[model samples]
Target: MSISDQIERLATAKANIAAAIESKGVDVPEGASISDMAALVVKIPVFTEEEVFLAAHPVGSYFKTASKGDPGEIYGGRWELDPSLGAFRWRRIE
Candidate 1:
């Protein structure tokens, strides 16, 4: 498929995923992309100790920890400042 077509398809998929997440009563953060919400919803096991540690905390909780001078690691992911949101968002590495 053409690049534009692929992008359009992806956008549609993201919208659908976002709807599903909302239907589940999970709050999708403002300014967060659907893909980000999907990542939060679906937990693919990477079989690591860190993953276990991360599974216990809810999304965005780690940002608070990091802000207190702790390491920037959040539930097995990392926190990066999203300038658009003017806040730190959890980013899971795949």
Candidate 2:
């Protein structure tokens, strides 16, 4: 498919996912949680951890401590993932 076609499909898929999630009564952050926006990223041929972080951290600034990690450091913005970590990292976008 053409690039435009791919983009359109992605956009549609994202919208559908958003609607589905909204239907679930979950408050989705505008630019956080690729999974929250899985409708779009899941359709892509490939995605990266960084992209996930970007998707989850739309504010592009600020940081929060990961619930589980070395018991310190690795703030939310650092983008570290560990089974011990519990809190979801995110950015507040206006």
Candidate 3:
């Protein structure tokens, strides 16, 4: 296929995947996981240990972490920031 045709196909696929996830009432942060996408499954992307800390401690001048190495680790493949608790909390991907 031509480069333009390939790009169009990929874009269409992405939109379809996103629409399918929304229909199932799921939210994908950043982007949907690749493995289960074709199945229209809500596969939440698992973050690396270091990435968790970085997210919790966003590097903007105004952002600060309560302490070092304290983004709270992801459990069961998903991590959510709980403002009420002021910490990262484990949440189910499915």
Quality of model 3 by C-alpha lDDT: 0.51
Error of 2 at 61 (Å): 54
Name the regions of candidate 2 deviating beyond 4 angstroms: 36-94
Q: Give the TM-score comparing model 3 with the true structure, all chains together.
A: 0.34
Better of 2 and 3 by lDDT: 2
Candidate 1 residue runs with Cα over 4 Å from true position: 42-94
Cand. 1 TM to true fold: 0.38
User: How well is each residue in 5-77 modelled by candidate 1, as lDDT tens digits?
Assistant: 9999988987777777777666667767865886778643334666566665445553333343323443335
Give me the displacement of residue 93 in model 2, in angstroms. Answer: 47
For model 1 the local lDDT of residue 38 reads 64
Candidate 2 lDDT over 1-94, as tens digits, reads: 9999999997788777777666655555686545656554444345566556555565544335554342113322333333334464433342
lDDT of 3 by residue, 1-94 (tens): 9999998998788877777676666664456555546554635455676666555544331222453232234322233433435633433232
**Consecutive 10-residue window with the lowest summed lDDT within model 1:** 62-71
Residue-level lDDT for 52 in candidate 3: 66
Candidate 3 at residue 46, lDDT? 55
Better of 1 and 2 by TM-score: 1
lDDT of each: 0.58, 0.52, 0.51
